[model samples]
Target: MTLSFDGTVIVPAADPDDGERTAEALVPHLTPTSSVIIVNVIEKAGGAPDKASMEQREKHAEDIFERTRRPLQSTDAALETDILYGTDIVERIFAEAQDRTADAVVFAPREGNRLAELLTGDVARRLVKEASVPVVALPQRDV
Candidate 1:
């Protein structure tokens, strides 16, 4: 089945590199009228002491957006960026998708080992299993 990227899509990036890669992978699938909302989730420490200052995290998120924006500049897609905060990454992403009435949540799976995925709660798996809308996993192109 073919997937269309003609409506709002929620893209959650882990970091600058991931943002760029995911954006690159998604570019080929986008239409001129697509609305791409790229987001970076700052996984808050709940009530515990934070890992980094909020300012630092926000700056990092901006960096991610900058890198992500480069690839999509070639397309006519309306690009936007947001910084999301939550303890659960997947939940935050789905929340954004719901809030935006997104047509799809698209991403390129990050590479990791089984042990790492298990330790980190395997967000990629959860994204697919718990999606509220169409979830698209774009194949990562070889660098």
Candidate 2:
């Protein structure tokens, strides 16, 4: 069945490192008939940032898209992009996944996880916990 897959990538540092390769490794998704939405979450100042700052952040995300777009574009499936502001990305990722009617959500491993998971504050753990649709989380396993 055709479905939308949510591939949300977030990097804590200033660099625009993508969570794509890891996210893809976790989930065998994105068929040619399936639609994929590539999302990047930027933490807004929460209130107001100077227009310049906002523009810079958007540009940063755009830069990430440009850098990250190759793999998605090279894939057989059609892909789209989105930029969103969220104080808490884990929450936003799940919300967006549901809002977009994604049949499944794929994410790269983060350092946050329940103390029990032996993983530690990782988005991957949260996605597995909260995602309504099936969530695929690839750990940092060297292949």
Candidate 3:
């Protein structure tokens, strides 16, 4: 039987070091039949980021998506990228999952703050708790 999933992966604007590894963690579980959506949640500010800042952020997001896309293709799954703007990432994630009817939501967790994260949920933990769909959170790997 071909397992199908309408899954949405939240690819936040990640830094260089561990972004590759975090993306790799999500690849194996995604089959060819999965409808993969790569979501980049933009932070909505009182005033939008300046042109240079905006361009830089968008470029960073695009790069992360590019790096992430390569591994999933081996599974014969295509990745679609989307940008969402909201003040809070957790809320944006929740809304996207509900709107897309996503079966699963994947995210690369922020580094460190492990204990504080569990005690006082940051974006990933909070989203996992409140996600309309199941949230698969991947932590950054130790080098």
Candidate 4:
């Protein structure tokens, strides 16, 4: 069977490099018709941040998307950006993938300490296992 992907590339603001790495991984697999949506979840574990407002967060996410788009643009793929807010990061990501009719979800696996994983709840792992679409995590490589 011929394989194809209309994908969403999921990246967190804390690790924006993941988006760039994911774009690199997708280069060989993507067709000209492939649609790539780059998503960054502005994760707020609590209601209404006292420091940064939603507008500020959105502008920051927009700037991150602006930089992230260049590499994906090199492949001649249709690219879009999505910024979401919530504590349920994985759920929001899955929602976007389904809404976009994505055939796959691409990501760069993040290596975090046990404490951080416990606190943040291993989103990459959960997304890989639970997503309806195929989750393609770019292999971890040394810089």
Off by over 4 Å in 2: 1-15, 23-28, 45-52, 110-120, 139-143
Candidate 3 lDDT over 1-98, as tens digits, reads 53234444444434433346655666656666677777676676657654347677778777867776776667766668777777777788778877
Give the runs in model 3 whose Cα sits over 4 Å from its true position: 1-19, 47-52, 108-110, 114-121, 138-143
What is the number of residue pairs that collide in model 2?
8
lDDT of each: 0.93, 0.58, 0.65, 0.70
Report the C-alpha lDDT of model 1 over 1-143, residue by residue, as the tens digit.
Answer: 75569899999998999999999999888899899999999999989999999999999999999999999999999999999999999999999999999999999999899999999899989999998888999998767
Candidate 4 colliding pairs? none
Model 3, 87: alpha-carbon shift in Å? 1.1
Task: State the RMSD for candidate 4.
Answer: 3.1
Tell how far residue 91 is off in model 2, in angstroms: 1.5
Question: 1-143 in candidate 4: lDDT tens per residue?
Answer: 54446444444433456666666666666678777778888778575543577788788787778766766777867877878876778888888777777777777676679899889778887887788777777664444
* C-alpha RMSD of each candidate structure in angstroms: 1.2, 5.6, 4.2, 3.1
Q: Which order, best to worst by lDDT?
A: 1, 4, 3, 2
Better of 3 and 4 by TM-score: 4
Worst 10 residues of 4 by lDDT: 6-15
- 34-92 per-residue lDDT for model 2 (tens digits): 66666777765567664357678788778766655565565666566778778776677
Question: What lDDT is reached at residue 81 by model 3?
Answer: 76
